[model samples]
Target: MEHNKRFLLVHPEISRNKYNFAGIIDNEPLELEYIYSMLKSMGYEPDIWDGQVETVSLAEKLKSFMPGYVYVCGRTRQESFMKEYCANSKEICGSTTFVGGIHAQHNYKHFYEDSIDFIMTSFDMFAIADILCGKSLSEIDGVCFKSGGIWQENAPKPFDAERLPVPDRTYFYAHLDRYRYLELLPCAHVRTAYSCPYRCKFCYRNRLNCGVYSARSIASVVEEIKGIECENIYIIDDDFLVDAERILEFVRLIKKNNIRKKYVCYGRADFISGHPDLMKQLKEIGFYYILVGLEAVSDRYLSDYNKLSDMSCNISAVEILNNVGINIMGMFIIDLDFKPRDFRELYKWIKSHKLRHTAISIFTPEMSSELMEQYKSRLITDAPCDWDYLHVVAKPSNMSVKQFYFHYHILAAKLFIKGWREGIYDFVDYGFYIRTILKNMFGFGG
Candidate 1:
């Protein structure tokens, strides 16, 4: 590959079912922005096409730019689209295609076929830059590529979060309005930390790097926030509210700089429960929404999932956020062991708690998680793409497959109506809802 070759980064279109975007949220392609910035810094002409935002044909873009390299990134659910796009790019432009992201990080072997030329095992920006600069794959720190028809791998280098650059938001200028967190439109994403300190069994963060918690400097984080053009900012940390001192310092920085963007982020229930003052301070500083993983309604499910916190903690956290006038986007996992009564109980619990915004996902033990092995025997399908958490991946223990889906859709519709009553826009067309209901009624999602 030439050192100064043009590069095209493709964010492959994924199934709407996987993310269940339903037009409620369309996250900006922050990962691509990082890569684009890194490549540009190293003197490479790089451009991005976000599948979620861009309507243009990737093939046509490839033909126009005629890049020498095409980089594709996505999660396990997007593996099929990634491979197909890579193969198509290779067929069309004969570009050297490289794959990365969560899917490639843990499952490089799955990408060893001819369609994929190299797989980046770590998202270390410098390592990727080195490879793109035409450095030999063997010399690079975290990549796997074929050498004389044999797949060879390199040990990944330690990622220095301190060196993370301010992302190139200009790339997303055209469709900034589409990205959001509910009503918080034109949202931009910023990362304050890497992995979570607490290990939840069903989470995918641990698989990226086990027990690793690295955070960017406060000044750096604030600088990124200041540079963001969008009114809403989503700190895409696994858990942003872990450290009390850090949160205080961050709040101080925001106050010092007078950065007043509406913020949404992930936080633990225990953190909010223990720090009511901090919650109030966050609200005072424009933290309008907090996405809490109230994973289950029952303590038994919480303990089984190693959530570490109990139902009381979750309730306390919600109450605290409500007191501070901050919206709670409560996330829950549907247990395969759930009976018909369990669904009704959870709905009742949500309603009784006055939870306006909620998100529900089936209990899916994703790729590379420790739970995958235990859940393997009970898996409904062997396809990697089907483990998206949108589908009931495991066999239902208490109800028929159809019955499980029936209750699931009922709850989803109920949540939608509740959100609508609370003024959450049904962003998609009315026909889309009709089609979804029809599909669900016929038991199609599984």
Candidate 2:
């Protein structure tokens, strides 16, 4: 509501599941919504254009809403292709386009001479207002812009973890049907806090954020929930149950509000093993599932990756969470170390215990992860993200790339069939899987 302040926030509609090469991937753009809400809090009028509805006519939105600036969040591996299209669209419409997010942030220098007027990292979205209101670009922090044919970099302004805004789900409200398992409600995503306490090597959060973490007050959260209409909320926090006391407070508030919605969130096994009561309470409050990064099943594999999750905790945590009747989506990374028996154990475990789903990703050393640094000398593919190489980037000391790729897909197909047999299909949002199967079996998705 700041007079004379207006912005058009664009959450580039990207392939929801990375493998989709055909249909427009329609998933909630949680990160851009966060920026939109922040702009609103700063008194700026903001409009959301979920690229899935149709190609963004930057010209149409600017002529209609007449916002002075644009804020966008795009991913690296998956949505990299859409960035240029969005920037060109914005330029064609005559709006100042400022881009942010992991890909834009890391490679701002790489794509400096385009329709992107400014490139930013995870935080400091508000400062963009300063740029649009005629303030000298020099005063704005966390922006990378061109001057005199050269790109100037400003220190990334801190992501105000404490003052984080509730994302504006209205952007995706009408188009909720495009997402996986979200047709059930006008689903929304909220972060209980900002930044993860741990810094895993292969994660952008670790490479970009600080060791310090911040949690939103339970009262503030309940107030935000009052305005959202969805019955199912996906807690997009890096780890929702990280703070046990805060979760307890959140659960109590939900009960008091008489809100009824199932929830899904990320959690760490060590933390869950330490506090079963929180998991139990979360389960009581419509918390239907938890996504835990059980990176590896063996201690050697986990220690090698610095994940700090052991096979013992993996087994125990799965059993405990299941005992509470809350489904677990165990994410496991397959490497040369995991043999055919390990594969059998993993599938058997999910089938026997009834896990919601599992992402058996053949470890692709993420952008700045330790795996990337460790294997950079021996990496087979170095291009930012071809998507095709997402399966075989990280070759184990023992296995061949072809071997890893073949086993990876074969096992994944088996797991999909297994989940289908058990009637547990909505667990993982792998639209890419359906697209791949269709392309081969029915000649579609390409």
Candidate 3:
């Protein structure tokens, strides 16, 4: 075979059974698209296989494309699938397999399997290009590779969001109709920053990029937005509402350039509560939805999580977003120490706030988070996938495992019923979700 210069990039799918809300929200493979853009600039053939939306099997793609290099990326929940894809690619074509993503970046050792040739610990696409072009593994920075049966890792480099190339977005445009965030159909993912600025003790995002926060200029962000075809843009920043002046500039630029697009982004409750005027300005500039982490209903739990936001702040955030006519996706965490009354209180809080869109997740101690050590001895399951926030990985302090799950399911059911009565989430089939949740409940109990 003439020196094959083709590269295959993959985004693995999550098992529906493992994650009940699998089909509710699917984002574009923005990372793989960036890699694809870089590869194309180097005059190499690159193709993306998004398992989330693509009907084609990885086996078929490997056989047909016969790529010399295969790269796969995913989060902690999709770790098994990432490994499976790498193993399959290696066995099918003997291609050099690589893995990279948020999960792999922090837990690179988790992917030191025989089939995977390299693990990318940072956003260093040039290093990959060099490796493909016959450069030695020792010469690259931000990579882990085996040499003579021993694994060696190079020091990782910090990533600059402003320096990133305009992502090709070919894959995004190809399956534009399939991507979504709840009701926002055909949604697109855009990144304005790398890692997070706030240091929430329970969150793993703040630990990324060597704990450094870098953002692109507002002008650059707006320029990229101009090229995006989708009207619904999901800004994948850990927290987009961090800087006040930057957001004001973004709103000004969006209006000045006459680029109209609805945006969905992650934000902190304290920021929203403190800057009600900015929230109004954001709504005026087409910010349709903001996902606020109202992690708990009590200040004690909030303080324990080091969230630095009180229950009053969360309530104010809900009121502000509601007044501004922007949808508020209230995200809450159910602590392991909760009793039946805590769940009831949470439901009552959501009901009283009149919030139609809510996401309730069990308090999950991620393997990469500093809180893991505190809960390590109390962990009930060693399985990596069980840490997805849906499973109660740690033993509950005030209740049995069965009781915890029962109350959790009851809370979910009550929320779903309320949302349904209020005529929300019509885009999804409630019956299907209910069935899936029930199945998971019984399966977990058994």
Q: Top model by lDDT, which number?
A: 3
List the candidates' TM-scores in order: 0.95, 0.85, 0.97
lDDT of each: 0.82, 0.67, 0.88
Q: Which ten residues in a row have the lowest lDDT in candidate 2?
A: 437-446
What TM-score does candidate 3 get on C-alpha atoms?
Answer: 0.97
Question: Per-prediction count of colliding residue pairs?
Answer: 0, 6, 0
Alpha-carbon error at 368 in model 3, in Å? 3.3
Candidate 3 has which clashing residue pairs, if any? none
Give the winner by lDDT: 1 or 2.
1
- Tell how far residue 201 is off in model 3, in angstroms: 0.9
Q: Write the per-residue lDDT of candidate 3 for residues 1-446, one digit (tens) a residue.
A: 13477889999876544464656799889999889999999988999998888888999999999988899998887888899999998899888888998899888999999999999998767778777777777888899999889889998888888888889998888887889998888999999998898888889888888889989999999999998999999999999999999999999999999988999999999999999999999998899999999998899998988898898899999999999999999999988999999999999999998888999989888886778889999999877777678889999999999899999988988998898888888888888878866776676632
The best-first sequence of candidates by TM-score reads 3, 1, 2
Deviation in Å, model 2, residue 288 alpha carbon: 0.9
